[model samples]
Target: MEIAIIKYNAGNTQSVLFALQRLGYKAVVTDDKKILSNADKVIFPGVGNAGAAMQSLQLTGLDKLIPALTQPVLGVCVGMQLLCNYSEEANTNCLGIINTSVKKFVSATKKIPHMGWNTIYNFNSILLDGVKQHEFVYYVHSYYAALCNASIATTDYILPYSAMLQQDNFYGVQFHAEKSAKAGDKILLNFLQLT
Candidate 1:
């Protein structure tokens, strides 16, 4: 199957490419509208500032191209945050595929960036197939999407936030499934098998 990784100016593209390669899938990393639209599956992975990233996407016209994709689209980390309605990262607006906003972790005792491994509580999703409930997943982010109506899974560091989101053909994950272990691989495989 053809998998396209949306190549914007954001970071973390190489790691995701490597992960897909490890899964025996050679994914194409591109920003062309036609290439992205024609893919069987699309993965949006980013690790960078929201405002700047959004600006870059807008510059390349990918900001509009991504949400219009008809195939199963997956967003990881910051890519997931950008799929929401808005983000407080830079008081920025985002693709409104999911009606949620990104918020900074309010922790006086813990830490700001919710790093390391955390358990993801699965509710119900095709992406969670073969993955156990409350499975541990790797995360590294300061902002999080609040658990809204579209939330398919939840995780907690300072408080419970959306670990996974789903709306129609669009799917998003706050944690890095590419970094998470076997559970992560299962999640990717599940997304790849989406029909």
Candidate 2:
């Protein structure tokens, strides 16, 4: 299977590639428009400021390529944020593939970067196959996509936010599925099985 992982100025590409390798799938990291367009599946994995990430994508023309993808495209963490309409991070506009906005987490007692394992619930999608309700998944992010019509699942940190989002063939996850364990693996597999 030709699984393409978007290569850009972001962190955690190696981890995502390794995760896919562990699943016995060989995924390539590339920004080539053809490779991305022809891939069986595409994974947009990242960890960094949303604005910087957008800059990198635009620099490589990936910002335009990403939104036009017709295949199953999965965005992780900040990648998910970039799929939204806008991000508060540096006041940047996103790909607008999903009509939502990303906002920083505000809490009375919780700290920023809602890191560590968190539970996701109220999700029902082919991408979430084998994932139990309220299953724990790893997370390490500060900004979150507010709940919207595209939300497939919700997670609570200081408040409820979109844990998983889907719009057409584009799917996104607010959590780090690469770092997440068994549940995360299932999510990836389910995505690959999508037609």
On lDDT, the leading prediction is 2
Compared with the true structure, what per-residue lDDT tens digits does model 1 show for residues 1-195? Answer: 889999988858898898888988899988878889999999999897998889999999888888888899999999999999999999989998899899888877997688999998857798897888888999999999999999999997888999999999999989999999999999988998899
Q: Tens digit of lDDT per residue, candidate 2, span 66-180?
A: 9999999999999899999999999999999999999988887898889899999998687887789999999999899999999999999999999999999999999988889
Give candidate 2's TM-score: 0.98
After superposition, the stretches of candidate 2 with alpha carbons farther than 4 Å from their true spots are: none
Candidate 1 Cα misplacement greater than 4 A, ranges: none
Q: What is the lDDT of residue 191 in candidate 1?
A: 92
**Local distance difference test scores for all models:** 0.91, 0.91
